[model samples]
Target chain A: MFYDNEMTLSFRAISSNEAFARVSVAAFALQLDPAVSEITEIKTAVSEAVTNSIIHAYDNGDGIVHIWCGCAGNKLYIEISDNGKGIENIETAMEPLFTTKPEQERSGLGFTIMQSFMNNIEVSSELGRGTKVTMEKSIGE
Target chain B: MSVGFKTLNNCLIVEIDGEIDHHFVDNVKKSIDSQAVQKGYSNIIFDFKNVDFMDSAGIGMIIGRYKFTKKNGGITSVACLSDNLKRIMMVSGLYRIIKIYNTVEEATKAV
Candidate 1:
């Protein structure tokens, strides 16, 4: 089935923009009229993905992060991409409590939270190219 | 990024206001850690009365504090959590380790 509604947002990979990206996705997903819990789930998952891009991608430098959200029927689809240093070991990165920036208080639970909140999540990356994460959740489930 | 700290009898009650995400979870951790560990506090009560929202980053921040307090033989508890915050923490299994009370006073009493 095709998306009944879709929106794309592009912003600088900055820590401050994390909140903007989360709220923007949440607002767009609101079109599905999800429950309060569903809304929070999307907001939290989006925040985690956007934060990872800002922290791991740009590494305090500069880059672009793109977020795309769409809804069809009761399913919400989200994609967050960044053009920066990509993950070396996708499996290791997805492991619970595995964070490269341990000294920075990173619990390495970003992907864990996303997977737990959403129905599905896919992470694709290239060593020197970039990374893209796609996730989806069904409302009222 | 404001956290109000009230120290009472070696217990620190933190009033966490505003939305908590990666944007300010670091500051929250720093502020609470300084007061809990450096100030020699034995119990930490996170008063989430004003916390509007919290993402996974908040969970990480709380875990970091929990670990720090554990090393010092301190107790960690939460109070006044919004429904959203409570659900997020619950799904992350935070309630299993940290006790949640309806009020800061209740948490302190149990401590």
Candidate 2:
């Protein structure tokens, strides 16, 4: 027997609400009994991904950020999708310490941090087609 | 997250309570550094006795402080890391640069 669990959330592209979304997701996924550090890592990875969508994908606050999560077997998958300015160079964007907005004090470590926390990260984007990031992590022993 | 600072024997003790993630990393870093510098403390002790959660941002904050304190010829030690956080810290290679102690007193004595 197999059980599939899924959750979804939509939020504005603002910084203050980013943390709220992250904590909410982690709390909902608590059934996995993730270690405290693992929980924090997952939340941080989600926060960075969502923040990137808001700050880079959208301009003039023009769209919504969609996040979805699912758990199957021992793996948890999270997807963040945005309909905004698409990435012209995904490779450049994923590079460490690379940011289009340096004046905002952006560390450019968002992608780097995301990669570090999760087991796997997949990104899909097209010029003006928006971007979608899917990340996965394992839970328990 | 809650942050408190105190000085003892020329060492600055910063006690962090709760999760340290992207949400709280900046403020924690700012608060600790400002208070430590203002108090004119050379050595520092980070009391993570109550911290059950931490992320890469937290790692960055700690590393940044170690660098800052090292530049002043000072030292930094972390005390009471929960098992999970200790594992993350180890994987991130933080233990190599910052000493880890079982108790705040031990950290204080070492620093």
Per-residue lDDT for A53 in model 1? 91
* Regions of model 2 farther than 4 Å from truth: A1-3, A31-41, A51-64, A83-117, A126-130, A138-141
- In candidate 1, residue A3 scores what lDDT? 85
Number of the top candidate by lDDT? 1
lDDT of 2 by residue, B1-111 (tens): 699987877899998988776557656787788887898887889889898766556676777788779988999889999887787676566788889999888887776
lDDT of 1: 0.87
> First chain of model 2: TM-score?
0.94
Candidate 1 per-residue lDDT, tens place, A1-141, comes to 588999999999888898889889999988888898888888889999999998997786799999898899989999999989999999999998799998887778889889988999999999879999999999987
Model 1: native contacts recovered, as a fraction: 0.59
Q: Taking the candidates one at a time, how many backbone clashes does each contain?
A: 0, 0
TM-score of each: 0.93, 0.77
Candidate 1 has a TM-score of 0.93
For candidate 1, the docking band is medium
Query: Which window of 10 residues has the lowest lDDT sum in candidate 2 chain A?
Result: A101-110
Find the candidate with the highest DockQ and give its number: 1
